[model samples]
Target: MREDTKYALITGASGDIGREIAIALAKQGFHLYLHYNRNEKAIALLQEELVLFGVDVIPIQADFTNSDAISRLQDSVFQLDVFVHAAGNSYYGLFQDMPDQEIANLWDIHVHFPMQLLQKWIPKLQRSDAGRIIFISSIWGEVGAAMEVAYSAVKGAQIAFCKALAQEIAASGTTVNVVSPGMVDTKMNHLFDEEEKTALLTDIPMHRFAKPSEVGEVVAFLASDRASYMTGQTMRLDGGWFMR
Candidate 1:
């Protein structure tokens, strides 16, 4: 990677949203460091696709559940122009029945590791002309759900983390923001039954789940020069599913 080519690191690059973000940023002339825990094949294919944009596609992997897993990533991120945290999971179960490990792992994935990596990227991000930090949060973070209590909790934490960190680093010219997307059409929502899916569809004013491409567009904008003034904002792409 050259010093002049702008760099963007996207976690969970094999995922629906992360993959779209990779493409979106690539289109914006960002050399990408695509991070994935598994699914090397998917990432390889995505890397192939992104190379058509004529930007560098560097695929890296790390287990988000482990604290020291992402330490090696420090060596790869030479210049981080944009940092996008899109790696996360959703737990669908009774809140009381949730195991302690489930909550801990969820928090580690959605909150801890992201903050850790962001801290490491702060210096490099500050050096870039366009420094942007974007987190792909959930609409459930805004409006709690009956079955997704733990998911909502960590997501709420992510939102709060973005707000606080935005202020802490505002003087550095780095813009931090969270993109809270509603029921996005992804494998993460495969657990829902036909009836439950129908019920969820009715709640969205648009009568449709959000597309990953739609969320990617917002993220790309925040990373672009036009959105330099935006920070600490939780922009929703939920189709009025959980309007504030």
Candidate 2:
């Protein structure tokens, strides 16, 4: 790797939103560490696509549910110029009916694993002149959702974590921010059919879902020198759903 080259590790890079964010960062001239849990095929294809941009792309597998994965991740990457935590799943069910294991998994994947990565990579990021940490948070983190109680809790934890960490690391020249998207058209919404989607659309002022590329572009910007002064902010990518 070239000494002048920059590295970005994006968790959940095989997913729709995370894939777009990886591509966008590749376009920004970043060598990428694409992290995916079990989707080797998807990560392979994404790695090929990212390589087209003339930047180094490496695919890594680590299940966030396992504590061992965090150790493996820490051993895999030495220095990180950018870190984007896009790894998480949505829980869509009644809170009372949810199992303890499900809630634990939600907190593990959404909070604990991310905290471990941030803690591990923060020092490496501090060494870079343009370090960036971005979390793909959700509108549920702010106003939250009805059936997504556990999901909302974890996402809310992520936002709070980013806010506090950003303040703590500001003088290190690293910027931390959250891109809390509203209703994005990703696999996470697969549970909702056209009818359900239509009903959900009624709540959004834009009457539509945001494209993955839209969120990706904002992430790219945040990772760039352009967003240097911006940190500790939750930039809602929601189409006026939870405007504050």
Candidate 3:
């Protein structure tokens, strides 16, 4: 909120990676604008933890699928130094088996929300001395996954948005980039059995799945001045899962 200070707006802050990023950024003396769609309990505990770090943590709720909620959020946070669009959902099944509405839902959450947020944040960020915009995409976005057509499409859209936005914001000292993580160990994939997990690991050079904190650390780095020259690129933290 202060010009002499920095603030981070992290969406999907209730999730594993998002929560880790919130903690890491808080430790870095960042005022946090944490957004969560549901799970108030997790958000409450996270708010308490962030406050323990002696930083301001504001927990807000917004359904990425809703345009009205997003507009309200943009109005609430007039200016932000950093933004991480990490809220997304996926359904794993045959493309033909998935409902049409499911595909639309993924597009709204993964594609439309990030685009709209950037449309609102970019100008404000341009007014700042420096700013960072990070999009959490996936390896599937880079190389399409067989059963994740809609998810992959949305992720791919994010990647495209990052590249184009990077070029648009470069002259303004605002960086836009994408971070694509591969097969992260999150509750979303807890449905996998041991054999399924092992099967997924066998293809990866790093046999073990990546921890959420591992991805968060990279995000913190990018949000820092260290990545000043880095823009228009999608950095993959996939543990050798996708060589791209």
Q: Among these predicted structures, which one has the highest lDDT?
A: 2
For candidate 3, the lDDT comes to 0.87
Estimate TM-scores for all models.
0.97, 0.97, 0.97
Clashing pairs in 3: none
The 10-residue segment with the lowest total lDDT in model 2: 235-244
The weakest ten consecutive residues by lDDT in model 3 span 121-130
Q: Please give the CA lDDT of all the candidate structures.
A: 0.90, 0.91, 0.87
Tell me the tens digit of each residue's lDDT in model 2 across 1-244. Answer: 5568899999999899999999999998999999999889999888777768998888889999999988998889976899999988877889999999999999998899889888878999999989999999898889878999999999999999999999999999899999999889988888998899999899899899999999999999999999999999999988877666
TM-score for candidate 3, residues paired by index: 0.97
Provide the RMSD of all predictions against the true structure, rounded to 1 decimal: 1.1, 1.0, 1.1
Give a tens-digit lDDT track for model 1, residues 164-190.
999999999999999999899999998
State the local distance difference test value for candidate 1: 0.90
